[model samples]
Target: MPAADAEVLIVGAGPVGLLLACFLGRTGIPTILLERRSSRGPGSKAIGITPTSLEVLAELGLVDRFLARGVQVRSAAVHADEDARPRPLARLELGGPGAAFPFILSLPQVDTEALLREALGRWPAVRLREGTEAVEVRQESSSVTVRARGPSGGETLLRAPLLAACDGAGSPMAGLLGLRRRVRRFPVAFRMGDYRDESGLGPVAHLYFTRLGSVESFPMPGGLRRWIVQATGAEEPEPSFEKVEAQVLARTGQRLDPGGRVWASAFRPERTELERFRAGRVVFCGDAAHTMPPIGGQGMNTGFADARLLARVLERCRRGGENLENLLALYEPYRRTGFRAAARRSRLFMGVGTLRAAAPRALRNLLVPVLTRPPLSRTLVGHFTMVNVPYSTLSGVLARERRLRLAGEGQADEASGG
Candidate 1:
C-alpha cells in the first residue's frame, strides 16, 4: 500500500489477503498487499480446513506445504457428555474427481499464513508490506487512492486500478463506505487456549456437549493442542484460566493441565455480511465481506475460496483497460452465498455445542432423537463435521430451512432458515 501505484491493492495481509496474493502471483497477475499488524498475532485460531479447501490449495500448488505440516483428520468424534464415548461424525467416503485428498485437515491459521507467505516469496510480481495500515480509500472511474500509515510514524499512499478489502470483520474500508453488514452476536462466549500436551485424547478432535457448558480440544501440528470452554457472556469478559479449567474439567470429568497454556483468549461466535461487497473500484473479500463463528472454521477457508474466485474472475476479463467492472459482478453471489450459508450453519453448531441454557439443552436432548430417527447420533454427527456444506447445495437450503423450522420452535429454527 506504500507505493504510488499498483495493479491490485489488497487491504489485509491475513490468510485471505496473502493467499490471494500467491494465487494472483502464480497466475501472472501483479499485486500489492498491506496489513495493519506489525507481525503475526498471538493465539491459534481457525484450525480446521475442509476437503474442498484442500482442493483449492492443490490448485495453487501450495497443498504440499500444508499437507506436510497439517494432520489429515479423516474422522472426527463428538460426544453428548464428557465421559460419553465419542462417535465418528463422518468418514471420508467420497472426494470428487480432481479433488486433493478427501478428508479434512487441521492446520492453525498462522501456519496456513506462513505457507502462503513462502509461496508468495517465489513470485516477484507480488509485493507485501507489513506494518502498514489503511486509513482512507477513494475510488474513481478507473483507479483507487489508498492512504496508509506504517508501524513507525510514516505515511504512505497507493494508487491502483482495483482494490480488495480483506482487512477482516472490523473492516475500515467497508465502514468508511457506509456499508452495513448484518452481525448476529450469539449470547455465548468461548475461551480458547493452545497448549503442548500429549494426552490420552486420540488423534481426532473432541467435542463435549455437557449440561454445564461445552469443552472441546483439537490437535494441532507438533504435539500442540487447542482447547475451548464456554463462558456466560453476562459475567465479566471471562472469569480466569482457573475458572476456565475448572469448568472444562467439570464438563469433561477429566484432569487437564493448567500450566501447559501457550495462548488464551475469549471470543464471541458472531456472524456478519457486508451489505455491498463492491463499489466503484474497491471491493471486499474474506472477513471484510463476512465473518462467522470459528466453530467449523469455514471463516478462513471460505475467505480463501472468495480470493480464488475473485482473482480468476478478474483474470478472465477482456484485457483492454482492466477497469474491474466485470470482475466485480462475480464477487457477490459466489462469496456472499457461502458466507451467509456458513454463518447460519455455525450459529446452529454454537447452539448445539454450548447448549447455552438449561431449557435449550433439555429441548435438544429430547427432540434430537425424534428428529434424527433411527441411529440418530450416527446421522446428525455428519452435520457438525461440515461434511454437508458443499454437498448440500444452495437450492436445498430453502428446504432445510423449512424442515428445521418445523422441528425446533425458536430463533435457532428461524436463523437456520435464512
Candidate 2:
C-alpha cells in the first residue's frame, strides 16, 4: 500500500477507539478502526460516565445522542456498612445550577459504543472493520503496516502514518511496539452485573464497605441497575442471577433475587500502566496505556477521555508535520503524569476495598474520610471526573474554591458547599 493511503490506523474498536475515530472523522481526517471481534458482545460493564466525561462528550457534540439513550446519575453514596442505609458520598451537579448537564450519565458500554459507531459511521472518511484481527504491526520512520486477518481469514494490509493502540489491557499493538508496562496486582475478586431492581434505591450511587469487601450499586436507564459484590469464596465464573440474591438480601433486607440479572462477570482489580504512552509513529490509547481497578469507577470513563484528548493532539500534529516527534513529546509527559497519579490512587483504593491487611485497613478508614473532606475530597472528585484533567480540571477546582473561600469572611465557599 502507498503511504498516501495511510493516514491514521487504530487497532481496537472499543469505546476508546470508536470515540477517537468519531472525533477525528468529524474533522475530516481519514481513519480506519479495526476490531478483532465481529460483533458487539453481550455484557454490561462500565456504564458510569462521570460528570467531567459528560462535559467532554458534549464538547465533542456527541452527548445529545448519547444522553438520549442513556440515564443521568445525580449522586453517589457510600455506607459505613453493607446493611447500613446508603449515605451520600459525592453529589454530582452534572447540571449545576448553571451547568448544561450536571449529572453523571449512565449507559452500558455497548450502548455508548453503538451510538459512537452509529455517529462515526455517517462520515464517509471513517471505516470500521469487524472480524479483523491485527496479525502483525511493523512500524518504520514513515508509517506502519498493520496486517489484519480480514473476513474469511485472508490478510488485509493497512498502511497508516500513525497507529494508536486502543486495544484494551491485553493490547496486541502495545506488545508489538515493545512498550513495557508495570502491573500491580489488586488482591480480590469482584462479581459484577447489570440487573433490574424495583426497590427504591433513590438518587445516590451506593458503595458499601465491609470487612469482607466492597459492593456497590448504581441506578441506570431502561429500568436497569448495576451491582458489584466483593467475593471471598471459590465461586463460579460469570456469576448467575441466583448468586446476586444473597447480596440483594443483605443490602435491601427484603428477598432473594429482587432484580432480574442482565450481565455478570468476575474480575480481579489490578493496575497496569505503561512507562510511555507513545513510541515513534505509534501511540497507546485507553487500557492500552493504563489499566486500573474498577473501584473508583474511572476505568472506561478515563479511557474514553484519553481517546478524545489524544485524537485532538494527533490531528493537530497531522496538520503540521509528517513526523510525530513533536506530538509524542507533547503527549507522553502529560499521559505519564496522569497514569502515575491514577495508579497510586488505584492501589490505595484496592488495598482499602480488599482490606486483607489490618494496618492498611486502620489507615484507610482514617485516611479516606480525611482525604474526602472539603478540599481533599473535591480535588479527588475533580480528578475522578477528569475535570481536573488535561487543562482546567484541578485548576478550576482550586480557582473556584479560592474565589469562594476568599469571598467568605470566615469560611471557604466550595469548602462549605463540599
Best by TM-score: 2
Give me candidate 1's TM-score against the actual structure: 0.83
List, residue by residue over 1-418, the lDDT tens digit for candidate 1.
3444768899998888987898778777778898888777776678887776776788888788898899776545555642353332322223333445755688888888888888998988888888889898887767898888988969877898889888988799988778898878877788877777556675677777776778777778888777788885475355366666677677766555877767777787778878888877787888888888887667887787788777766666534454456446646755676677677777777777777466776676656445444355433434444544542222243355567767766766688894
**lDDT (C-alpha) at residue 119 in model 2:** 86
Q: Report how far off residue 350 is in candidate 1 (Å).
A: 0.9
RMSD of each: 8.1, 8.0
> All candidates' lDDT scores?
0.73, 0.71
TM-score per candidate, in order?
Answer: 0.83, 0.83
lDDT of 1 at 154: 93
Q: Which ten residues in a row have the lowest lDDT in candidate 2?
A: 86-95
Question: Which regions of candidate 1 deviate over 4 angstroms?
Answer: 1-4, 82-99, 318-324, 356-418
Query: What would the per-residue lDDT of candidate 2 be over residues 222-275, giving only the tens digit for each residue?
Result: 886787777777543466556666765665442435447677787877788887
